[model samples]
Target chain A: MATTAGERESSLWVILLTFAVAMLFSVVSLPEFIPWQLGYLRPQWVELVLIYWIMALPHRVGIFSAWVLGLFVDVLTGSLLGQHGVAFIIVAYIASSLYQRLRMFAVWQQSLIIFVTIGISQLVNFWVENFVGLSQWDMRFLLSALVSAMLWPWVFLVLRHLRRLFNVS
Target chain B: MIGLTLLSIALMVVDHLSDLLDEVRSGLTVVVTPVYIVADYPNRAADLAQQMFTSRDGLQEQVISLEEQLLLMKVKTEKMSALTAENNRLRDLLGSAAKLQDNVLVAELVGVDPDPNKHEVVIDKGTQHDVFVGQPVLDAEGLMGQVIEVSPLTSRVLLISDQSHSVPVQVVRSNLRLIAQGTGVTRQLDLMHVQGTADIKQGDLLVSSGLGNRFPVGYPVGIVTQFKHNPSEPFAKATANPSAMLDRSRYVLLVFTEASLREPVIGAEG
Candidate 1:
């Protein structure tokens, strides 16, 4: 789609606002604020947000942004630096490369793809965490991937609505 | 992609092997602190509103109970003064230096580590408040953790239950010293290298030995909750529940003790 000068300028603002809100969601939805027993069920909000943006506007949200955002998440969570950065870059690359095909899929199929993408990211994270001896082999780490997959349809709809409202394209 | 992955690996290795990236992490933390403040706003607002709407009768009842507890504490402190003087005399007789009382600053928890595998928290106090890495922290009950990273306005605490953390502890009843390692589980620590014949028992109070100088001596660390001695094994496995409420504490005390003021030897704990 061709964009006018005004549309391009407004798209920049919309992108920034969406990313800021996503970061806010990642920070505010930490499991610490919830009951301790249910901490393992916390969804990967930042990952899901990255996936949605990359899928929607592959040309705009690319690998560099993913890497930087991952670093922000790492520092925010006080985890090993670069752990999330690598995972995010991989996820962003896959989403952008598959964006055309992804757009044609149903919401449920897209969620299944999200499950695979996030699961891959989680695996990368687990591998790095294991390399540094920071994490053990536990099946519970995959729970976030499952939860993120479950939430993908709603997230996709909300972001789609906001994108249309702002003429983000 | 490969180049970027390689760069990230290098960053991680550099971060783990030295203090080179600490300054970078602290600088980035300044940018991220606002996110945490914004995240905490709703909870803080609710607390404020709750306080404002509390009934006067309820406030009065709370004040009365607090005053009664204060009175009881004052009586106990009066007795403590006499015991302290006698203890000082005994130390002098033994030609040992008198223990200096530690000064403490109260700090509120600002953020908690989101990773379920890691037990850590950030506090409001930081380098500006004279908070240093390795400074011991405590809640009302017992030792909580030590500062691992300090930024300008905040610091990160590695809790005693973190997988990477270990503390030297001694049994109060038997005076047997052992190392307690964090099991990555809340309120639990594993005593490492304990012999099956060791005199540890259930409910034995474990206190910091102050041998490594990382933590101050005689602070309650935990109480033994389980001891298993398998005849086939060379060492007994024992676990203790930490005295501090690692999961529930909201405020903690930063202790400025004389020993902690000394420079911490790098890689000393290993």
Candidate 2:
């Protein structure tokens, strides 16, 4: 089980690549002029990616990295600074605590957890936005969670493959 | 975990309740800009591909039509010079403010606010380009918005159609002062505190009144599309279509007011 330095370095790079792709997707909306009702379809890409990494490597990608990632997201999205940081910290805390059970569950059941975790994260966003008087309808929170849950299986498979390919463990 | 979460909450509260995080946010914006620039490549590429694939005949037709439109606009503006001189003379008689032509810089819309709750766009121009906060932005049609945040390489614009945004406007026909509030819809604006007996009609024009001095005077704001009077409500209801294409325009002009122009030595930066 002698892992070379190159492999270890590559594992970090792979994780970064996933996060970068997620950030890119998080900021982009297809067609750019979508109506308000259709906005929930824009899945929380950064949160999804963070969930996968924390689940896969609970020791390596823990609360600190999640907070840093969330800070970047806050800047990228132009929200109140550290708003996403709060959400990501909470999600990371929950995901690491439940990582074993999450790994043991079926894909469908894993989505249920994702639904709750992402919903919790979106709740933080919703609450912060409301506090700042940038309120949207309540439907947006639930619909965004549903959409993120629906995308969980695909996101898990892809990240797992990348982890396996790069030996991220 | 608790410590970090507390830090996050503290950061949010401080950022929201005070200007303590403005400098921090601006510094971070410089770092995050590269990701947005990379993400925006697809849109720029799509535009280029469309231009590359367009038929030569189609481009020729477009150029011809644009030239004709330019000619028509030139004819319309030909009388503006005389009118401006007359207006200036009348203003001089009244001891009003001088209407010096504003220097404007062109900027391209680079990225949009990721949140659906806000109507904001990031433009390519920034403090590097002398794009300061509260600077007025415009398209060829009319006033679009004002700059709210300025970083070194980019600035954020709060569009006139945001629910939180409002512009002081006056009716063109009756010269009655009113306030136009954004309805969170790009095509509509609500005239607040309108009296039931107000003279606003379906086609009346609205212009910036320059009362707050955010937007310059006489720029078209919107054209009234609907008005209603209800005895139950305290104020009459009226809505107008925004003159600028809030959701459509890709390029906008950033205006440098006379007050801001006095700071930097004119020949120093240029």
**How do the predictions measure up, each by TM-score?**
0.92, 0.94
Worst 10 residues of 1 chain A by lDDT: A29-38
lDDT of 1 by residue, B1-270 (tens): 778878888888898899899989888888888877777676577779989999999999999999999999889877877776787788889998636356678888877776778888888888878889899999988889999998888899999999989999999999999999999989789999999999999999999998888887888999999999999999999999999988778799888776655432222110
**What is the alpha-carbon interface RMSD for each candidate?**
2.2, 1.6
Off by over 4 Å in 2: A2-6, A32-36, B262-270
Q: After superposition, how far is residue B39 of candidate 2 from its true place, in Å?
A: 1.7
Clashing pairs in 1: none
lDDT of 2 by residue, A65-143 (tens): 9999999898887788889999999889989999999999999998999999989999988989888888766666677
Query: Per-residue alpha-carbon lDDT of model 2 for B134-200, expressed as tens digits?
Result: 9889988998999988889999999899899999999999998999988777788999999999988
